[model samples]
Target: MPTYPLLAPPPLSSGSPSAHPPSIVTSLVPPMFNAQAEESPKNLILKKVMNELDRINNGMNKSITLNSPTINDLEDCCVKSALNCFQSKVLYLSVPDGKLKKLQIIISNELHKIVNRVSDCKPKELEKAQCKPCDSYKEVDSQTFVQNLKTLLQKIYASQP
Candidate 1:
């Protein structure tokens, strides 16, 4: 019967001075497997969702064209992008125990608050030189909506296994 070699080669003979140093042996061996290197599918999906959310947040931070767009117009853009993100990405994410669904509802409610606040103000009120809403909305504050969303997203990402 033929005998097979061991899975690992026998240790190098210590008597002879080796041409290759011990560092060379360490370098030749492949690095240990890292769980983080292979991100879960859910993690990848969440990353994409967060990226879209960041884009929306960044867009809101910049001052748009100075052509005097109505507050409603700006709010509408934010709302539409948010809804699109939920529909296209967040809804389909595979999260544990319906967490993604819960997040969706929260985001939707916040967007609605923004929409209602913008709509409540009469065009004339906005037209007046310096009258902005006192930033009061019972459901959600539009001014801090992006920050709140980011916080929620961070919590969700950290909860991932």
Candidate 2:
């Protein structure tokens, strides 16, 4: 059996100044949200959206034979396409452009519904040889073709200074 030491530190009183810890941590100031901040880190969310779009666009062109895609891939592409459609429609809206409050939250709920519907699945074998020529012909998967067209439309409508 080990013996306990008799000496113990006094309990801190709530009123004592020394009881408070020195705050040496510096808090970073968040970038101001305005027209200038539009191009700053404030637009990181927008960048995330663009990155997802790029990833989906790239995935659409992946070689069917090399990738050996399953039905899950097709379902994923469709789900992503639907989500992006909702995201793009709301994410770019200026405050003055829409009367809806918490547009992001609204879009989030819509995306959640899409995901929930496909939450459970069993993988099944898919025939890849039938689509092998698609990669060679630079064919886009119809599953993601609408998104591709939407992206091109966005590019066409883009404004510059």
Candidate 3:
């Protein structure tokens, strides 16, 4: 059998350098992480991305669309796009991270609370807001339709194995 310490995990000859440390480093190396630091291009790239996102989020002007003649009448398109982006970007429970489950549970419970709040409302309340009950009713029916389609797709995927 091969020895440890001086071996250095075969020098990572693979193209992607799949890490395969032979012996545990915790037993050998000192507890200082700063001494083992390497150049992390990913950290630099992530910092740049975060800076760009911050700039975009803070600098975006809604008045650009508001003042434009073409989009002035097409405000509904902008609203729909914003709502679609929100829905699409929601990190669902199916994500690999455990924290997403907490967020999912919180969001699910909050939506339930919102629905419960509105469930006992009078017809006049909806009418005053110019909101029809049928507006969200259609969305609910469509959501169910899409969910059923997704279940069918899951079944097909399972059958492939």
Candidate 4:
């Protein structure tokens, strides 16, 4: 059986000049953390959804712009694209470490919060800003954000086996 808490080089071949096996220094190596106990994707998403529901109770607390603006007026598409690209380029991402759903929820919540804010409504429960907020967001803009987020949520729901 192999030894524990101690190890040394095995004996050399018959012609080896050195008689002794190399001595190994004993040190307490810290136990490496392989991973954390992560929440299931569905549960995590549900928690966010439920939290938003609780916070709103009846309806939004922030003021929403009556009629959100047009593609040309409401928000700068260029800025959105630039930020998206910049973040993708700079963010440290790895498969095992990626919080994909959390990222999606945080971003989606921010956009929705922007809409509600103009309406004079309360931000969603998950409304805490985690990243740069969207600039020039308005209430009377195209309904793209709502539709896009709805579809994305649907896709996420359907994608899970």
- State which candidate has the highest TM-score: 1
Q: What are the per-model C-alpha RMSD values against the true structure?
A: 15.5, 18.3, 20.6, 16.7
lDDT tens string, model 3, 97-129?
445445434433433332232223355653444
Candidates in order have lDDT scores of 0.41, 0.36, 0.33, 0.36
Better of 1 and 3 by TM-score: 1
Model 4 stretches astray by more than 4 angstroms: 1-39, 50-57, 61-63, 66-150
Choose 1 or 4, whichever is better by TM-score. Answer: 1
* TM per candidate: 0.34, 0.23, 0.21, 0.23
**Shift of residue 82 alpha carbon in model 3, Å:** 14
Question: Where does model 3 exceed 4 Å of error?
Answer: 1-96, 118-121, 132-161
- Record all residue pairs in model 3 with backbone atoms less than 3 Å apart, i.e. clashing: none
- Looking at model 2, residue 65 earns an lDDT score of 18
Candidate 1 wrongly placed segments (more than 4 Å): 1-31, 35-37, 61-143
Give one digit per residue, the lDDT tens place, for model 4 in 1-161.
54433455555566364864667454546666768667555535634644443333222222222222223431222323323322232122111223543453454454343333222213442243222333433433113333333333343345444
Ranking by TM-score: 1, 4, 2, 3
Residue 26 of model 1 has an lDDT of 67
Per residue, candidate 2 scores C-alpha lDDT tens digits across 1-161 of 43423342333468475765554333445665576523433133333444444444343423221211222333422433333344443333223323232443454444444334332322332232222221232333433443543353243224112
lDDT of 4: 0.36
Instruction: Name the 10 consecutive residues with the lowest summed lDDT in model 4.
Output: 86-95
Q: Candidate 2 — which residues are off by over 4 angstroms? A: 1-77, 97-101, 119-121, 124-161
Between candidates 1 and 4, the lDDT winner = 1
